[model samples]
Target: MFPEPNSELPEDPSAPEEAYLESPHHGFQGDRGAAPVQAAIPAALTIAVSREAGSRGSTIGARVGQKLGWQVYNQELLEYIAQEGTFRQELVENLTPGAGRWVEDRLQELLREQNLSQHPSIINLARLVLTLGAQGEVILIGRGAGCILPRASTLYVRIVAPLPDRVAYMSQWLRLTEEEAAEQVRLRDQRRANFLATHFHRPPGDVYQYDLLLNSSLLGEDLCAALIVQAARAKPGALRGKGL
Candidate 1:
């Protein structure tokens, strides 16, 4: 019972030029003129995909959103979150949930200057994620969304594979040498894991939070998305949207 794509996302007039930088999928244009419109999203289905480095979590999230005709938010979420002018670019780019890096400290300063009700970057991000989730038909990739949202309102998926397999996948997909790929994988995994553990107190790979966990190396991206779609449909209160 997948529905048509609700491609109309709220616009941020104050979004900086950097915010509109060409994300991986730039050709598919969406409405940029509308003020923030919050749709009625009761029974709206949201998917939060958290993955180990090189697990192709973002790729799978894209495929699932495309097939289901929903909006997939990845790098764009960063832009959306920062549009309110509370988060500085350097801070937003470098802030992590883990130990206070210099950038994180700067972000805290900016938050204080803005006098935002939500001071922590993690809290602000969680607010944005929940807002988008309430609008429904969204697939949020990374930024610790699965841990922040209510388990009842969202489908949390974790993607993982053997270290060697993930490293190899990154090498092939990104055209990096195996050694380079391995380093990228290691760093990214640590960063994500630390972000989650530090802010949410939840380990990235904790099995308890997920509705489904898949090994991307075994299932591949397409099959992994297919399985998630099937599972989402089977979940009680089936994801029925505006125009199925």
Candidate 2:
């Protein structure tokens, strides 16, 4: 999926007289124009899935990836960060779910340090996502990828379920009581919303950010996946390269 590499340009004739006298090279050769660069068509589908806790978002993303023969990048992105940052993968994974608030605050504080020479790790994550997107396709779960790559021809889907349904699902999934599950969901949602607002300066619940917002409670996962596949397939000139 890389863009065509540019050819070397002809030597400039506007050099200073002393430099021209010192140099052995003189007149330029005829132009050896190379063929126009063509971008390769991506073989896999790139999807970004965002959902509240206990919405079965990961499960649905996994199924979609399997159907399309694409790799799922949900928590695997943390592994990438761990490798790049020289941190423990498990530590990064543990810091992912509702850990955005702590990470954002810590990174913000780090940015304020005058001695800091490099961008925060969060910026590194954005670069990694963009690079991976250029190299074929993968399903990215959470981490605000929708906001990060808003211009790409990405299938941005947000999954939402009724509060009661989400609570019930979380109770079973997390082995927690109904009351505890409800509280956990509430806190996690609030944490995610705050994190997005702090970093992206936009509301997390904004419907305009997503191309498709599916209510998992109303539509089954299979139906939702089918609809997404159909919609993506029907879109014209989506996979064409606009620019590198």
Candidate 3:
């Protein structure tokens, strides 16, 4: 079994656009899109998924990857790094794909997020995400990928369900009592809200920002996966600048 992985924002209805969910992928260092990083437009398509508490986001993501025959990246970034040596070998060959300094330049920009430039883990994770976004044909879940990758080349999907359904799902999945499940769900939802606020400065569960917003309870994992696959296939993701 895989371990579970880990934004707030208020919306102004009168505003034309939400600066919180901007195109620039400033990510964890600060508010989403608040900082600018220069990079080229990505030509390949990538899918970024943000899911509701107690939802089958990880399952749906893996199903989508299977259907699309693409690699699914979820949970802690370190798990993939430590467990898959083959991945490490492959990363070297794909580091610099073209004339653009997208990978290197993007890495530097990502450093400004937390101002922890010397932090190896943070640097490694940022580099991995930027590179993955560049490579395309990948599905990334959580870790603020929605805010970290370019909007043009990534298909952002949000999965949600009613509170009651989520409570039930959590209770069953985690083998907890109903009350315990409810508390767990609340804790999770609040954490996500905080994360969005900290990183993206957007309201909790900002459905409008995503390209496709799904109710996993209604669509089910397979159907949700199918829909995401359809949307991703409909358009090829592209990176526009010389830089992720």
Candidate 4:
């Protein structure tokens, strides 16, 4: 298995609007109710998985989605954003590569230029995530989905691994030397931290933001997914009538 990178930084913090514009995951434009896939799934449970770089959060999310037979909102978010905004698919894909500095910058600009109303993409993405939560089971990975839909009947999870473990994972996955992986981790973590701080004004590692924090290296992906699924099922009224 290709080890995932340890951290992913936002492309640029100064121009979030551009980031939103360039992002394929921002939101769709024109017709408001275009994404019918969200409506097809039955309402049951919603899971939001946030993680440090190289923590295997995406793997865990995919496993959870498979076990539950629910839609996994991972990279598919980019497609949604592209469709919603009527942006060229290729441009969005290029912007979303790796850390996504260009996309982040665009996002910053959008936030500054137009209040939330003007940038329907960001608002709609948030709304769509919430709508998915309301309609059926989902596993959302990253893009501040956890923070945006805090009150929704959702299980917010954070997955982290020790620095050494993350570095090792990245080295193997990226086919880089250990030192190179370490450097990449440092830069990526810094970028992600800055993005969260600059845009959301919240610390990225805030424990209060997550319902549960799991050490992926310790528990492994399958166990972590099982734990999340268990928690989601056990929590009463977790996904009731909550709204964004």
Give TM per candidate. Answer: 0.65, 0.66, 0.69, 0.63
Order of candidate numbers by lDDT, starting with the best: 3, 1, 4, 2
Question: In the order shown, what is each candidate's alpha-carbon RMSD?
Answer: 21.3, 12.8, 22.8, 24.1
| Highest-scoring model, TM-score | 3
lDDT of 1 by residue, 87-189 (tens): 4344334423322232234335534654223535555675566556555678889987776555556888999989999999899998999999999999999
Which tens-of-lDDT digit does each residue in 112-224 have in candidate 4?
A: 65422334455555445544554547788876666555344568899999999999998998999999999988997787677556545667798987888999999999999
Tens digits of per-residue lDDT for model 3, 1-244: 5435523344678765746556467464554655575444464788998888888898899999999999998866534662455785467466555513575676666555643234454455555677777778899988667766767788999989999999999999999999999999999888877766665556657677798999999989999999999989874522233342
Worst 10 residues of 2 by lDDT: 110-119
So what's the TM-score on candidate 2? 0.66
What is the TM-score of candidate 1?
0.65
**Ranking under TM-score, best-scoring first?**
3, 2, 1, 4
Which residue pairs in model 2 clash with each other? Answer: none
> Could you tell me how far off, in angstroms, the CA of residue 24 lies in candidate 4 after the best superposition?
61
* Clashing pairs for predicted structure model 1, backbone only: none
Worst 10 residues of 1 by lDDT: 95-104
Q: Is candidate 2 or candidate 4 better by lDDT?
A: 4
For model 4, how big is the CA root-mean-square deviation? 24.1
